[model samples]
Target chain A: AQSVTQPDIHITVSEGASLELRCNYSYGATPYLFWYVQSPGQGLQLLLKYFSGDTLVQGIKGFEAEFKRSQSSFNLRKPSVHWSDAAEYFCADYDSWGKLQFGAGTQVVVTP
Target chain B: SAVISQKPSRDICQRGTSLTIQCQVDSQVTMMFWYRQQPGQSLTLIATANQGSEATYESGFVIDKFPISRPNLTFSTLTVSNMSPEDSSIYLCSVERQGRDGYTFGSGTRLTVV
Candidate 1:
């Protein structure tokens, strides 16, 4: 079974500061990694995804993620975060049946 | 990305009752999935709603509890049967769009059981 692990339960960052959220996965074959963001009481929005191209994939909202096969990781990063960026971030991978297996999610808090 | 919508964005139901959540997509899709997000927990896939076929449920999930319907490429529904306090959670419907680029999810139906 494929699984995702987001190490940070909650992350606090000052506005306009750099941000990075750690994510690790456990899978036997090549993994299809993704990052998604969710606002309070809203649906999830796709951040980025890594399938078979360049390890570094850029996504919407100035977010990006790098997929590292060796470390079994695909961590999300952003140079500067705005207050609106505060939300829950989830890392996910595809299962054998092509269904998604999601991480516990990392809650990002932007401090002014 | 695909535009998605879910009905009854939220509902509070008495215990032992049932609620059906509807998911509508703007275009045809190959795969439709139902997921459950418990309070403060990750999204747990409930089933894969395939068009014209029975849904495939995940471990610990039964068809009797979560009956799903995928009538066509752009419409699906999930019914939470015999609700309980434990059933209170956000139920999301997603579609696999653009040949697996990513999943586009509905706004989610927040269910509260009392």
Candidate 2:
């Protein structure tokens, strides 16, 4: 049984500020982690994924995440936040059967 | 990656009525999945549809409530039988492609049961 935990329920950041969303997972083996973003009334879009990589994986929309095995974390980060970046983000892990287990999700609010 | 087209986009149905959601993929895929997102919540896997076989449902989901059909590699349908207000949620279709770590999702079908 694999599970994901997102510590933050909501986060508000100013435009041009650096942002990081925390994600931790519980998996027995090497985990496949992913970050996804969804705007209101829209389907989810993949931000990035980590399978077996160079620790740091870059994704679309200038987002990046680092897979830390020691801490069991894959946190999403952005150098500068934009107003358009306001959306709900989800962290997920896949089981051996390829079923996705998602975190509760974190809603990001970007302000000018 | 595969692109999915799902419909009807949104529907308001009465209690006890059934709704069938369709998912069509642009490219053939090995696995087609169904998910449900309750209000302000994360997505929960409903079932996995495999071509030429029966759908495998997750825990807390039963085939009697959610009947799924995968006629081929690129198309599937999920029907919510004997729906209730608690069944009001966004139903999504997804496909996994080879060599991709992530799954591509359809723009979910929002079902509002009254």
Candidate 3:
């Protein structure tokens, strides 16, 4: 079975600082990768996705992720962090059956 | 993108009771997925509801525990049966976007079993 792993359980970043969230998957081939954000008391929102073509994918809310097949990783990065960005981030992979497998998630805390 | 309306945004229930969550999609879809999110945890798929057929349950989930109904293409329901405090979690419904490889999810139903 395919699985997603998010090594970081929590990350604290100062406002306006750079942020990065790591995600790795265990699959023989490159699966459909995705990044989602969940605000406190909210549902999951699609940040971006990568199926094929460009390695760099841009998503809503000024978020971007890089798909590196060699490392089996799709890490999300933001140039600058905002207080609103403080939330839970989940990395997932879609299977052939179109079901999604999500990582444990990383809680991001933005500080002043 | 598709819009989903999920009812009973939240509810507090006593143990051994049951609560049903409904999800209605704006457009017709082939599959509607049900998921559970424990507090401070990631989402776990419960089952896949297909129109006019029995829902496919994931491992560790049974039809008796999460009986689903997909009477049509645009609507489906998931009932959390014999609820316990362990069943206290957010239940969400999702549908893959038509003509795309994306998915749209409902706002989720927050359930608290005491």
Candidate 4:
């Protein structure tokens, strides 16, 4: 079975500080990884995705993710955190049927 | 990127009632999916709505409980039958754009079964 794991449930970081959210996946084949962010009372917005190209993928809202095949992980990273960056982040991978299997999600709290 | 519109943004329904959520896409999509996100939890796929055929439900989900309909490539509906307080959650509709890696999601319908 394909599964996604987000180790951190909640993380707090100061504004202008760097951020990194860890994500790991369990799959037999090459995974199609994605990162999405959801603000309170809003819909999900796609941050980035790694299908079959470069390990480092850039996404909207100054977000980026690196897919590490060796570790079966695709973690999201940002150089500077902002107050608007406080949202729930979700990591996902596509299953055999091409349906998305999502992680438990990590809630990022940016403190000023 | 595809845009999705979902109606009934928030509703408080009585137990034993049913709620049907509608999803409309700006463009024709190959795949449409329904998902459930419980409070303080991750999103769980409910079913894949296929046009012109029966919807394919994921494990732990059933057609009778969460019936879905996809009459065309750009529209679909998901009905939560015989709702209970346990069924209170945010329901989202997603569309898979062909050749796109990520799916586009709706604003979601927050259903509260009281």
Candidate lDDT scores, in order, read 0.92, 0.93, 0.92, 0.92
Quote model 1's TM-score: 0.97
Which runs of model 1 end up more than 4 angstroms from their true locations?
none
Kindly state the fnat score of candidate 4: 0.82
Instruction: Quote the positional error of residue B35 for candidate 1 in Å.
Output: 0.4
Off by over 4 Å in 2: none
**What is model 2's DockQ versus the real complex?**
0.85
Which residue pairs collide, candidate 3? none
Tens digits of lDDT, candidate 2, A1-112: 7789999999999999999999999965978899999998999999999989599999999999999999999999999999999999999988767687789999999989
Task: Please give, as one word, the docking class of candidate 1.
Answer: high
Model 3 iRMSD vs. native: 1.0
The DockQ-based CAPRI class assigned to model 3 is medium
Winner by lDDT: 2
| lDDT by residue (tens digit), candidate 2, B63-112 | 99999999998999999999999999999999875765778899999999
lDDT of 3: 0.92
Residue range B1-114, candidate 1, lDDT tens digits? 789989989999999999999999998887799999999999999999989899999999999999998999999999999999999999999988686777989999999999
Query: Which has the greatest DockQ?
Result: 1
Model 2: share of true interface contacts reproduced: 0.76
Tens digits of per-residue lDDT for model 4, A6-96: 9999999999999999999996577888999999998898899988879999998898899988999999999999999999999988887
Interface RMSD of each: 0.6, 0.7, 1.0, 0.5
RMSD of each: 1.1, 1.1, 1.1, 1.1
lDDT of 3 at B62: 100
Residue B112, candidate 1: Cα error in Å is 0.6
Every candidate's DockQ is: 0.91, 0.85, 0.70, 0.89
Give fnat for candidate 1: 0.91
